[model samples]
Target: MSAPADATASRVPAGPMARFFRRLGEGRDNSLGLLAILIVLVVVLSFVSPYFLTATNLLNIGRGIAIVGIVAVGETIVIIAGGFDLSVGSVMAASGMIAGFLVTHGAPLPAAFAAALAVGALVGFINGAIISYARINPLIATLATLAIIRGLGYVISGGRELVISDEAFLTFGVGQVFGVPYIVILLVATFAVFAWLMPRTLFGRYAYAIGSSAKAAQRAGVPVSRWRIVYYVTCGLLSALAGLVFVARTGNAQPSAALGIELDVITAVILGGTSLTGGRGRLWGTFIGLLLLGVVNNGLILVGVPAFWQQVVKGTILLVAVLYDELRRNRVEEA
Candidate 1:
């Protein structure tokens, strides 16, 4: 009897829940936690605001977040590879103004569009070059670019808004397929492309490796500088694309557009599980975070919350996200 009892005790195995929790602690299932919170929010909001679950309101939320959501994808890639981009908002303003100015001056729509994109890519390249090649810290370098780009935007606009009257271009903002706005489709398409590419491609692997330890990745033969520039360029292109989208939606280019938007993108990315220190996060997490923020904002509006209060809430959420990332990072280092 004693021998049988010992065998049974020794054979006892860890259950599925325990394994799940272990993986969660290791940070592999962060999206799962975020997903649960999203679902709970949906449930609560559906009850709190009678309009929250309506199709029109939901679509409005999608449209509201599409710009930030699109930008966040590129930002996610940058962050994962141990980089930062504070110039996204400024780039958007500048790019939109560039396109608007050109087209309004009788430049063909295609040419103006291409010009905007090229300018954005150039700005990104410069930022990447300054940081990666010139060895300036990313925070300081991108901050400088942010100021420079915003200044460029104002200079181009001459402190006046560019009124866009092109119907073809404006359609991109309001056009819909199957009752879904084209902008929303764009957001989804971006998410899908990145989600597939990030995990299954060499670029993705290199990004993670670089973020995990740039010195180690360099020793392992990764072209660290080249890839860093490429990532920033991609971010720039995406930022320009977002600017075009903004121009279409608003039918005008204001130098002030997208001001302070970078902070919002950073907030969404961090909330989605991307670490400020880099090397850990997912696009899906960012997507969920985007929706969560959108829904929360929409809910607050329905509940008649003040605009200033919304800013305060957003700031608090960002702080919490940073704290969580710091705590998790510390725990990982200890482990």
Candidate 2:
């Protein structure tokens, strides 16, 4: 009997270990697989280009990805909530133009910055209102807004770029903290905040609920429409922030800047494992996805891949990611 008790006691410890391994496997299924892919890409690129592993080159790539990474956070949130915002690129243009134009015209930096954020909020409000109240489809609404907002940017800047000479403003783009670029710091902070928010907040839970089933969420006392509006507004705010950062980094705001960036942002988010149909994803995954794209772009240039082929490679990746997501979704449904 004592021997039997000893065996049972040993099995008790094994049970916890088994549970731990099971949870680890689940996390791997969700994100660790993507992490593994990123590591593989990094190793391959390091072998393909001597400069790819250099600190300077790595820092440059981080700075290059900063803007897109910031926007990707917003895109990830919108996707998680089952909405789309094709106008983000346009919003970046318009918001940057507003801030740059203001500062060039002697507006205080604070006021100009505030104005840019306000512009983003206003646009987001309109997007949310139209979708929530007018019942317009998000795709159609944002697509129309994309053109309208781009046009507005041109009108505001008279089809010219706005140059800002403020030293303080320039610092936002170029400054470093503890050897890390400010833009990279911003990207990391944004990711950190959202990562915490998504997994630990009531807002996140409600957003996921709405995305999974709006009617069901409503029945469960979630204000689906309101939360959706919040999501769109949040997306708009981040897009504006990205615009401001872009302007600071480049020292000018072109009315046509950020063209086609939406595609990149969307691709990164989707590739990070966010379901396009909504209701599942982690910000950490999105962060890795952003890094993967950044590394790929940097690696291609370092390897002497022609500019034209770069686009082709990116397009192929996007297509593959989308197909994979669709097939995965189908399997889940069938199961």
Candidate 3:
């Protein structure tokens, strides 16, 4: 008689690289492929443009996507934990406007900035509560918040762009630490911390557990509602951080800031190889994927691609990433 299939599979021995490839096939990692693609992209771009591989251009690419990278970090977390935050772009705009409005009204800079982050977290908490407790679909819930927050942004800014001139605040956008831009530093640090948390901490493990099988996790005594909310809150806070950074970099808070950024964030996460079905993905993949995105956009501009055509290219990449993930996963797991 043959042994049970599951038991037999459990006894199979595999080397480290073998295990990684197996998991890669299971939608657990895409960094290997993403890295290779990024390298090829860089090489090709370098051939087309003499400035593409220059120090200035490399740093420019890093700075160009720094804010998006920060937001994508948070989105990567929520996606891995089996949720989405479509409101991120709105949250960023709202938070930036909140800080801008407060600072302009004679409030202390620190206080105003803190308030922005607080509001971001509040919005996130609302999102989590709606999904985990109200049992609403995560997509629908966040999509609603996205509009609400953006409306509030318009109301807060009176539909005008607020110019910010505070030198301290502006320094983060302009200053460099040991020759690297502050925004890039923030991006790298954010990714590093979250990357560590996802694999080395209980919080990260719980995220995977919940994402992989919420029902099973609940049966094993995990607090599903609470943790799901935590994930959104974390995402919200980071979204807020990204917003502040955007305003600082651009030197103004526009009610319309971060418009259409949701696509960039989600596309970068998907391109990084995270499954829309959840319970899979890694930050390293997202980081590389983001660089790939930055390179493509920058390269196109250097080669004289029109703005509308550039947008078309972005949309195509996003579509392909989603299709690839869907084909690999085959089915979405129940929450």
Candidate 4:
């Protein structure tokens, strides 16, 4: 009888405590796995191309990823809250044009920059309002606004590129601080703020809760609509900031600037483990995703990959990342 009871106990499933420990172990393993992959990629690239490890090349990589990373941070927030903003690229273009117009009219540098940022926030606010108040889907609302904003950009520029000739602004575009590019510094600051906001604040927790389960969050007294709007507005504000950087870097506002940027921004966010279905993502993951793409781009160039092939490579990587995320998600669900 004792032997039969022992056999029954052995066949029984693990308790919650045992399961929790297993999950914790799996989480650590997954984290280490990603870190190992990153290290291997770095090491392999350095070996394959002598220039891949150079300071100058690393700086180039940093610069390339900076804006995308910034935008991805905002995207990550909105995604975490269970929404999408397709208009971000267009907002970037519009905000840049707004700044150019202000500067051309003798507006002070600071004022022009602020005005540009305001435009971006306003656009975001509009998106949020339409989605929440009007009860429209986020994707549809943002897509509509995207078209409208892009059209407005063309009208504002009279179908021309507004050449920015401001020396001060140009300085910011090319400036550096403490051996790091200004763009990189800006990206770091943005991420730091977001990193704190998402994990430590009421708004952040509510945002994630809402994304994870809107109905449940609502019942729990979370302000779903209000926080959703805030996320989109924040995204808009960041996109506008990216626009300023673009104008500063390029010294021109073309209606076509940042074309298809939304896709790239989303790609980075998704690659970083942010789910499009919402509720699961990390700002750090988005940062890593941006770096992964940035490194691939820079490394490809160093290896003499054709410019067109670069696009193909990026697209392929994005697809693979998405697939991997889906598989991982399904596995988690099954477990």
How large is the C-alpha RMSD of every model relative to the true structure?
2.6, 4.4, 4.5, 4.3
Query: Which portions of model 3 show Cα errors greater than 4 Å?
Result: 1-28, 331-335
Assess each prediction's global lDDT (C-alpha) against the native: 0.91, 0.88, 0.90, 0.86
Q: Per-candidate TM vs. native?
A: 0.94, 0.92, 0.91, 0.90
Error of 4 at 286 (Å): 0.7
Q: How do all the candidates rank in terms of lDDT, highest first?
A: 1, 3, 2, 4
Better of 1 and 3 by lDDT: 1
The candidate 3 region of ten consecutive residues with least summed lDDT is 326-335
N/CA/C clash count, model 3: 0
Q: Give residue 162's error in model 2 in angstroms.
A: 1.1
Q: Per-residue error at 41 for model 3, in Å?
A: 0.9
Candidate 2's residue-wise lDDT over 7-73, tens digit each? 9977775576576566445443445667778899999988888788898998999999999999999
Evaluation by lDDT, superior candidate among 1 and 2: 1
Model 1 root-mean-square deviation: 2.6
Q: Best TM-score goes to which candidate? A: 1
Clashing pairs in 3: none
Name the candidate, 3 or 4, with the larger TM-score value: 3
Across residues 1-335, which tens digit of lDDT does each residue of candidate 1 receive? Answer: 99999999778886988777777778667676677788998999899988889999999999999999989999999999999999999989898999998989889999989999998899889988998889999999999999998987778678899899999889989999999999999999999999899899988889999889999999999999998998899899999999999999999998999988987899899999999988888999999989888988898899899999999999998998899889888888998
> What lDDT does candidate 2 reach at residue 131?
91
Instruction: For residues 189-282, write the lDDT of model 4, one tens digit per residue.
Output: 9998998888899868987898899999999998888889899999999999999998888889888999977767888888777887788888
